[model samples]
Target: MISPRPSLAKRAFDVAASASALLVLSPVLLLAALAIRLESSGPVFYASWRVGAGYRRFRLFKFRTMYPDADQRLKDLAHLNQYAAEADAPEASGEGCAACAALEEGATCSPVLVGDGGEVICEAEHRRRQNAGPAFFKLQDDPRITRVGRFLRNTSIDELPQLVNILLGDMSLVGNRPLPLYEAEQLTADGDGARWMAPAGLTGLWQVTQRGTGEVSPEERIALDNTYAESHGLGFDLRLIAKTVPALFQSENV
Candidate 1:
């Protein structure tokens, strides 16, 4: 089982660092907020429900990086989703494997899975179907982003407001990133859920590992998150923070 409470050193560091960042970056925050407001007709800050450690839900704050109608515009841009299923992928027949089908009674697929329509599927097929699409949605050159928003995203200034979440003990300076509600829901399986073992954070292993390599597959992202969850500590977090400094300047928009 994952520990819900972080070590004293980790917690202490998060509190001190987050508070200091918020104080020192206050001017930048205000400027970003003003820029967002001037460019769009919505709240300067956006708060979306995110799942954190132990599957707890909290509102994650960010400088608004999309137009007010961004969510409404999502459906129109489904084709652009970087994680969407490939158009040429073969259809899943949902048929039992030959071995399992031959057994007629008693035995079943060695590793079984339940599907969305309440059907049982073998592991290989289940994995194939799952890998056919990703739970998280992201897009490169998303049309919903404003000019100012694009700058903020490129510089990651939009993520600075999450310092408040860290200050409030809702996150850490380094841990697996919190997931949006929809993303979190799709990650409930044991393999995927392993990511929830760590506290949510402003940045973490996957973000740093995938830096500048715009081709992070969903499975790879989750594997990195699981790695961090299994091994993060005060010293490791410090190392990640140091690496994060240089990563922040990378041109990769996501």
Candidate 2:
């Protein structure tokens, strides 16, 4: 899993390169912040819990691409999505089926979002989670993305702020895209999927590859991600990074 550990050179390169990218990307970050402020009535940066290496938790930073409190609404709407996926999977193949089924079953107030203590934290997190709902894990025609948000996502500006997460050592520049704690928990339940040893990334092998069009099942996505995790090395990471370049510029991810 994750080849036990990255070589010293790879680790050094990841940290050093991430630090360098942060400086180069600062101007773009400022512009993104200003754009968010100008177009939306909410805070410029949005931070949420993401599962990372060793299943450790951290705040994932991104430009505010949706309205505030968008996640909770999804919990309210999970049933509808499940119905649609179930209907479509018989024709489309059973990719996200099991994962979605598992997820939809637990749409209650998740402990990760609930914070360390009581109802107030839980309720507060519920609201924020609801706000982030429209763009949850897998999406098609999400209603929560603001007009500007759509533009930002299309041009990849929406993910730029995640560079900050890279700098804080919460993630890697290339690896698996971090899942929200709930999704990550579900993804790893099938132990030693090669997923347990990896950190969440700004972009990853799965994003560049399996993030292909259509509602990719979480099961398939995890399979691909774990495969990469199990085999990742300098050469493989280099190849994933090379593929990511075009995905970044291509607009259509897959």
Give the candidate number with the greatest TM-score. 1
Please give, for residues 1-254, the per-residue lDDT of candidate 1 as tens digits: 56756789999999999999999999999899899888879999999999999899999999999989998998798768776643213333344445565666755676878888887777655656665445778888999999999999989999999999999999999999899887888898988888888988899998887888887877788899899988888999999988998898888865
Lowest lDDT sum, 10 consecutive residues, model 1, at: 86-95
Q: State the displacement of the C-alpha of residue 174, model 2, in Å, after optimal TM-score superposition.
A: 1.0
TM-score against truth, every candidate: 0.85, 0.73
Stretches of model 2 off by over 4 angstroms after superposition: 1-6, 79-136, 251-254
CA shift at 220, candidate 1, in angstroms?
0.4
Q: Please, what is the whole-model Cα lDDT of each candidate in the order they appear? A: 0.84, 0.65
Sum up the clashes in candidate 2: 16
Question: After superposition, which runs of candidate 1 have C-alpha atoms over 4 Å from their true positions?
Answer: 86-133
Model 1, residue 135: distance off in Å is 1.4
Residue 201 of candidate 2: its Cα lDDT? 73
Error of 2 at 110 (Å): 30
